[model samples]
Target: MDEAALREMLDAVRSGAMTSDDAVAVLRRLPFADLGFARVDHHRALRLGMAETVYAPGKTPEQCAAIVAELLAQPGSSPVILSRADDEQAAAALAANPGGARTRATVVWRPAAERAERVVVVTAGTADQPVADECACTLAAHGFRPVRISDVGVAGLHRILDAVEELATADAVVVVAGMEGALASVVGGLTAAPVVAVPTSVGYGASLAGVTALLSMLASCASGITVVGIDNGFGAACAVVRLLPSAVTTRV
Candidate 1:
């Protein structure tokens, strides 16, 4: 339960609108509700700024559905995000909730879409789209409308420069690149917005399975770019979300 829901329950009990026993029944599940296989953390949103996210990498479809359902059942101002979902996981999460849609790793509430801020997701090539999509979708879940600029590898500087208008208006940017990871540095040089560098495993042998890209991003010449792990789109999304404007919200 969130603050508003908790307050409503308290008000009902104190005003005799709800019986003490009924109030107890409602609040008894405040912290969590056991589902045999999983214990859903209903109180996470109260402690953190958002609800507990679903990590669908290793979880079964049923478990992901149950966890997503439990999180949705809680009242909160922010939308929910599920990260690292493969195709099957994405399908399962969508099947679990009628309120959400298949968007990369998770589904989000439709009303929350209006609050989606502006962000730019720059990708080096088509190979990076999956990781780029993960970042974009995760940002959308956290209320950000991501502008995608794909196949703009540093090999052709003009391609990236062409999208300067969209890049300039963004509150933040996520750069997903695989090879030398030079796109993040170049984008960081062009924009004042926070740049989240995501290195993907899309390069050849010398790329060392994304390790080269990861190290390149970590050692970027750009002054203020932030580097997440190889293919860690979720981390980049969360970092951008934290920088979002703070508005007081009523939670249930």
Candidate 2:
């Protein structure tokens, strides 16, 4: 549970609207909930103002569904997220919790109330849209309105140039790029806000399936650029979220 939920529970107990035993029963599931193969962290939102996200790579469909369902069943308004879930896994999670909202490889439920943070998600090319979409989706889940600017690679400097004013307005920026990955560096130079770079596996031969882009981002000409792993749009969004102001929240 988040601080808000815990506070409400305690208030209810104090007001005599709920019995001590009932409050205790709700808190008995605190810290985490054990479900054999997994120990779902029910206290994450209380700790980080963000809930634990389920990554569906190694887990079975049933496991994915169970985790998402458990997260969705928590006592918070924050959205529960399942990332990179395959069709089967997505189906199971949806079946388990019909309220979920899906976007490509990401699914979210109970979207948090919008926070007053300006964030931007920029894509270097159309091929980088998937990574950008994931980043935008995560930002939305966290209640940040993401400004999207797509297909603005170095090949078309004019495109990014035209959006300079918009890019400069964000509290944080996430640049998703492949190839030489110079877009991140350019965006970094354009805005004083933190720039989180995400390299995608959307390049040819020497690009090394995003390794080259990752390296280029690491060696960016612009100073103070934050770079996440290849195709790690989620991490980029998390980086941006961490930089935002924190408040007590409930588990999603």
RMSD of each: 3.2, 2.3
Candidate 1's TM-score reads 0.85
- Clashing residue pairs for model 2: none
Cα error, candidate 2, residue 54 (Å): 1.0
Q: What C-alpha lDDT, on a 0 to 100 scale, does residue 129 get in candidate 1?
A: 91
Clashes in candidate 2: how many?
Answer: 0
Q: Candidate 1's error at 1, in angstroms? A: 4.1
The lDDT for every candidate, in the order shown, is 0.79, 0.89
Show where candidate 1 strays beyond 4 Å: 1-26, 86-92, 109-113, 249-252
Candidate 1, residues 48-164: lDDT per residue as tens digits?
A: 555667787779887887887877776555566666767776677778777676665555653244464678899999999988887877777666677889999999999999988
Report the C-alpha displacement of residue 11, candidate 2, in angstroms. 1.4
True lDDT of residue 135, candidate 1: 82
Q: What is the lDDT of residue 58 in candidate 2?
A: 95
